[model samples]
Target: MPVDFGPPRVDPFEQAIELGAGRVRRLRSVPSGPAAPAPVQVRLPRQRAGNCTTAPVRRRPVRRPGVPSAAVASEVARRVSDRRPAPRLRLTRRGRALVRTVVLVALAIAAIAIAVSSRADDVTPVSSRSMVVTEHDTLWTIAEEASPSRPRSETMAKIRELNHMPDATVHVGQRLLLPAP
Candidate 1:
């Protein structure tokens, strides 16, 4: 027996008549055994409900009058007008002199403190005559060597008076008389 493998016969005349009469056509002969065809798969298009674009529409920027511009000008004026009278810096001549005197005294005290601190490391105390007037010796150096224990301001004053120095300038090779301790 030869096997028959072909598409099942569909009656087009009967399908047309059934469709015209608005009736369903039932399959009369279904293939059996190995000759039966596999079921076909179909894909249908998906149906959308409404509008698909979900992004919001862009709007024009809003403009307000006398608000942003005045805010900037007011901020500038606020910073400009913040001069708080500069603390009324009224110093009389007496007060100015007092401040100058205090500053001078503080400078003198600091110079003395630096001199003492520098000499604190040296164990031996240098006598007044140990300092020699060399070509490169300055009045400040001479004072420092002569009276290392004394404040620099006092030593400088003593050296100035002893050497009869009109100003702070001292020439090289000039022998200066060291004051007594």
Candidate 2:
């Protein structure tokens, strides 16, 4: 191997200028005075070699066998920026389970809230009247007398449920709350 002590790589612009390849011309004259800052005269190439068009040349990305160009560009950008991809929101099994549980709880709470609100809208004030049990007054007799138009079985069930009576038996002089007639 030859010992190389020069710059690691040659500048393409300087190489072009030395080779007189593009017929580069200065756009403006450089100022020689110290009053203002040094003027940077940009020398633009007249025409690219082997191409006659003045329009900018667009370079196509090299296509690898199985790799896509977009992926390559994204990788290049990431490397150039010296930043790791925003740590992919990776979830472990426990993390996924926690997230799922939270979602389920939220859904359950929402469902409960909806059900409660809907039930609230349907609720009306129930006005109940009290009746004292007599010797002849049984549950069936009271239900029949209170709501004669309604079914006896339904009225009796409601009365038993209201009084928390496991069996259809009422002591004499016992106070009972009857549903609306």
The C-alpha local distance difference test score for the whole of candidate 2 amounts to 0.73
Alpha-carbon local distance difference test for all models = 0.63, 0.73
Model 1 off-target regions past 4 Å? 1-132
Highest-lDDT candidate: 2
**Superposition error at 18 for model 2 (Å):** 66
Consecutive 10-residue window with the lowest summed lDDT within model 2: 10-19
Considering every candidate listed, which one attains the maximal TM-score? 2
The sequence of per-residue lDDT tens digits that candidate 2 reaches over residues 10-60 is: 322332221244443433344455654433433434445677755654344
Deviation (Å) of 158 in candidate 1: 0.6
